[model samples]
Target: MQNLEEAELCFPQLLNISCKKHIRPQAEAMFIYIVLSSISLLTVALNLLVIISISHFRQLHTPTNLFILSLAVSDFLVGLLVMPFQILLTEPCWLLGDLVCALYYLLNFITLCASVFNMVLISVDRYVAICDPLHYPTKITAKRVQVCVFLCWGYSVFYSVMFLYDNLKQPGKYNSCYGECVINIIGPADLVLGFIIPISAITILYVRVFVVAVSQARAMRSHIISVTMKHSSTVTAKKSELKAARTLGIVVAVFLMCYCPYYCVSLSLVIGSSTEALMIFVAFFNSCLNPVIYALFYPWFRKSVKLIVTLEILQPHSCEANIL
Candidate 1:
């Protein structure tokens, strides 16, 4: 009986002060480790490819790609810094000390916030580009994008600090026992600030962009001559519709799909539970999905990946290669 009890304790030496080991099956734990580790590695690798693709290929540089690069940087950090720590959480106990746990949560807050904000920025960028194409060049310049990216990150840090203020002040205050790492997040505020605002902004902006795009498509078709031009005009009109649909599908649909459940779970105010972990992981999976979508939507990304994998970028003045 004593042996069994000791086995259940996270820190056997602590006796009464120790947290109990998580009561998951060995096989299940291994399965989770394998899956999450694979995701972490894939996230890191894919986001790294995006970072290299944008930074190395000179012609690929643009205001839009700059937002993507900022996103890749945040996603890259999520895979590198946050995911591994999260995986560690699936273990028997939190071996890392209290301050590390607090820091980990802080980093997680920053990255997730940065990702959502970056998406908003991307949505606004597209809105301007599509709805006001005439002013796009003058309005959404590279320098302006750089400033937005900087502010996005800065706000992420500020938001994180405000969100986790109490816990940051007293790391591990909510831990039930010595070997546990738990945090108490400020409520309603997380749901409102993190979920409602950003999601609403993205949805509204994308809806406007879609409306404009469809109208433009109709206008183009109306002006199209009805001769040999008919077939080509129809093709162009269809492409416009397809592009608008795709933007909605990828940006809004995927974002809602990934984030909704997590926020729904958060609404219940259940933090630091197995169910919460599952829901949060679903949200983090968005980082992994981002690069996949990029590869699908951006031809330059595919071309740049080819050049990068071939190591052709090592050649002299390879940045000048016109992948666009």
Candidate 2:
């Protein structure tokens, strides 16, 4: 009995103060690890492709693609850094020391904030494109998008520092035993700054976008009936309709499906033992889904993927190749 008890302790040498390791069946543990690892790899690969596709292709250097590149970079970091550490979080004990754990969560918060802000930028981009197409070119320039991306990341860093300042000042302050790693951001601050405000903004913007989209759709149908087929402006209107449809699908799925449940559960402060991990995984899974959505909906993404895989991207003047 003593042997079994010692085996269950995360640090057997520490005796009473050591955290008790939660052992699972070997097969179950292996299955869970395999699944999570696969997701981590997939997330990393997909986001990397997006980063490469946008960065390398000159034709993709528009304001919208620049926003996507920023989003991809954050998601890439999440997969590369955050998701792997999350796997560690699922382990019976944190093998890494308290300071590393603190820093890990710090990075996680920064990336999460960056992703949220990037989404906000994306929403704004789509809003202008759909609702005010005539002025979009002047209003949403590449220079402005680049500035927004820079500010988004800078704010994320500052916000995360403020959020984790206490924990950083006293690492392991919340740990009750050796071999454990846990820290909590202030609940009210997290709820307000991290969840409530951003979500509200995204919701309001999307609602306005939806309302405009409906009105425009009706207008387009009536215009098509009055206009002749030879009008090239009708083609431009049809293209805008398709872009709006794709943007709507991506925005709704990403915000509602991936982010909403996690924040709701977190803010509710009623994380079920069985559901907490699943909720977190769902949130991280969104990073991977974004690129896949692009691949499915954007032909340029498919073409870029093909070029990248075939190593044609290395050919002379490949960057200038007509992807559009």
Candidate 3:
């Protein structure tokens, strides 16, 4: 009876090689499951709302909104596909086979990379719009943004496949026992390709953006000092540019806050235990927070959500309604 009770193997029939399940307290596990599941559901719902709002409203079809739409799509997939599986990972045993596990992480990387790329595109869009307002319309058109979004997803797919080639080719390569799902890709490659390079690019772009924004602010102040009616239209355009820079700046800041800790740990090669789990979910939780950021900062997003919820979007010609 003692030996039978001590045998806590994930696969009872293959007890010799099977992974031992570290059974957490039932109540604790249940609570964790509930919380993570709720987060996943909320993430899916919020991002879906963002997706529906931007995609359905013709008035929201501007170049900037197109970037938002692409971002929401990536976050939506994170919620829909990635979060559920992530929940499974938190568990003690991996009932889903090794190939599925590899594929799950692969999808995870793709969605995350796509989100990062979308943010980069957004930063570039804002840079041009704010710093070079005259050429913005010509440079950052709807068609061009669409092409960029497609390429972002395509690149993400290729990168993820390339990074996880070994794991995909030979599933369970890292698992020492049955019913364990773990992939240990080298840190240096991920550190550079996933974190350092992209982060450096974003940092440089934002620095340039900030310098231009400060100069624009000074110029606007000078124009106000002159107090000329002829400069009224120019003042309004400058105000719009400053407002855009501020809003997107918040978006970038929030993204960095969420992602930085996880990457820092990865770069340091100190990932383990509950701290690692917390860091990962902290990053994942950013997906849920992004749409909320839009709601708070973007009046158009709030208006569009109202239209979507009230079934007003179903009305003919509703897409033409002035959301801005």
- Give per-residue CA lDDT, model 2, range 38-76, as digits (tens): 999999999999999999999999888898899999999
Q: Report the lDDT tens digits of candidate 3 across residue range 99-146.
A: 999999899999989988888998898889877899998999989999
Off by over 4 Å in 2: 225-234, 241-245
In angstroms, the error of model 3 at 7 is 5.1
* Candidate 3: segments with Cα more than 4 A from true spot: 1-7, 225-231
What overall lDDT goes with each candidate model?
Answer: 0.86, 0.85, 0.88
| Residue-level error in angstroms, candidate 2, position 168 | 1.1
Give each model a TM-score: 0.92, 0.94, 0.95
Error of 2 at 251 (Å): 3.7
Candidate 1 versus the native: TM-score?
0.92
After superposition, the stretches of candidate 1 with alpha carbons farther than 4 Å from their true spots are 226-249
- Residue range 1-324, candidate 1, lDDT tens digits: 999999999898989999888678889988999999999999999999999999998886888779889989998999999999999987879999999999999999999999899989988887887777668789999999999999999999999998888889999998889888888886688879887989899999888877887787787668666536547865664564446446534855676798899988888867777798998889888889988987888788899999999999999999999997
